[model samples]
Target: MTQSAARPAGRRGQRLTYLVKRLEMAERARMEEVLRPLGVTLHQYTALSILEAREGLSSAQLARRHVVTPQAMHQLIATMERDRLIERRPDEGNRRILRAWLTEHGVQVLKECHRAVDDVEERMLSRLAPEEAVAFGSALERCLESLTVPPEGLARHGDRTA
Candidate 1:
């Protein structure tokens, strides 16, 4: 039996997973509540940042950067287009390719969303010293890296030889 099986009903990762999901949903809702008043979604804000940071990216490239499928990116782009927050136009070098850019309205909205995220992070992590928060973030990254497996390979807790 797996370790999860040995544990009491729902007293494990699944429970933890649910809690994490709820926390994320709640946080996202809070972010939306703040951003909606200014006319934007968190995903839209992230896309705006990517657009500002990258000079030229096709929908496919942007989708890959965000680890989402092109279809999803198209939908997001369409919504942003309707909101006048972004523009998709043919790339100069490749007519078949499309590039996305943030509009001036998009820039203003992103700035506000950035401030909101900063405020949220500061409020949420106020209990932790800055260094402790940095260290904890680094540890989370390490834990995630440890969970990676070689192609066609697997391990239990990253310790089993395979």
Candidate 2:
């Protein structure tokens, strides 16, 4: 049998997912190392970035954006709050709804983290030409779009409330 046919059908379907997951783990590890001095994990850094662009997001909203369970986000937010990186307050209109916003310190730390992470990203993409980088980004977006369901009753990226 040819090499292609010799491989199990299940393994073929797993190849892409496996590679993507491995890349994600490697990227997270690199980010974790770079962000260690800032006392932030990849998840916290992501939350800070999200809050920087759009403040006052409810935990549920943040959870959806991060593709994490609400329970997981709750723990993350609580830790960030304790670290004074973010503040959580009840919405003025809805007392039951808690909104999260970055503190000034959070913004400052996030800026520093951005610079560090940017260096990491640059190193990762150094081999790709500008056009190739753009193409790769577009391809990743296409893959994400294919896997994600359309957000309903939610603001898209740039439309997020500040």
Candidate 3:
């Protein structure tokens, strides 16, 4: 059993999940401060980064990846298009479906955001030794996978539609 699993129930503050959530909140605050000057919210930065990696994704696809509703993603895409950070064109396969890609301006902005976010990440990881940092990331990935992937004969969380 894990250290947390072995521990007797106590204050909620003592839980590992609580500590992880606190860390996530702190990191998000720091990222927001850094990104604010660049006129990018965390959501926008994430969408831009995803578009850079996988161009031509529809808003629905982006929504699924973002774990948000398609309507929300549509609003975000519209905002980005207004900012000239992304362009949408009709898909060749389906003229009705519009696919999104980053513009040159978007790429430049994303690069700047990347550097700023990297600094935030570096600061967050500064306390850990290099090896410890790697292990921590691996452990977090395992934890995420355990939650996201359902056990055999069980339906996934929030997968009722599927």
Candidate 4:
């Protein structure tokens, strides 16, 4: 019996992993600096922002959009409810379904989050020209298309060849 090389391109895969970890750390540090004073984690801030935009969304829908589990979102909603940040009410036409909406407090917090987010974006991209920023973002979104994955970590579309 023989074992194939664990990774045919072992050094390249190691480089990829290191790059991902570095990026994740950098993003988390930036978000923490912006959000820590607001008393909301990045995920929580994101939830509030989404509710502010959509007003009312089911937990499932929120989870799908936020890339969180339904259970995780339920817990987050419970915390937000206790804080009076959001209110959940049964859908009028679908009594079985509950929609989450921003309370006045939620709106206020979202406004703060937006300001913080804007500050961060402006600082991060201030050196870029407007057209260059647009081009950079468009290119990033194209890169993101391949990053989307199913719950099981399988690519939803495109070849996984690497």
Q: Pick the candidate with the highest TM-score.
A: 3
Cα lDDT tens digits for candidate 3, 34-144:
999999999999999899989999999999888889999999999999999999999999999999999999999999999999999999999999999999898787667
Q: Lowest summed-lDDT stretch of 10 residues in model 2? A: 153-162
lDDT of 2 at 31: 95
**Which scores higher on TM-score, 2 or 4?**
2
Best by lDDT: 3
lDDT per residue, candidate 1, 20-102, as tens digits?
A: 57757877877777788777877877778888899468999999887788898899989998998888789888899988888
Q: Candidates' TM-scores?
A: 0.72, 0.78, 0.86, 0.73
Superposition error at 96 for model 3 (Å): 1.1
Ordered from best to worst TM-score, the candidate numbers read 3, 2, 4, 1
Please provide, for model 2 over 1-162, each residue's C-alpha lDDT reduced to its tens digit, 9 standing for 90 to 100: 798765434445666667778768888889999999989999999988898889999999999988899999999999999999999999999999999999998988999999999988888789899999999887677667555635552244322332
Residue 137 displacement in candidate 3 (angstroms): 0.6
Clashing pairs in 4: none
* TM-score, predicted candidate 2 vs. hidden true structure: 0.78
For each candidate in the order shown, give its overall lDDT on alpha carbons.
0.77, 0.86, 0.89, 0.80
Clashing pairs in 1: none
**Residue 139 lDDT (model 4):** 57
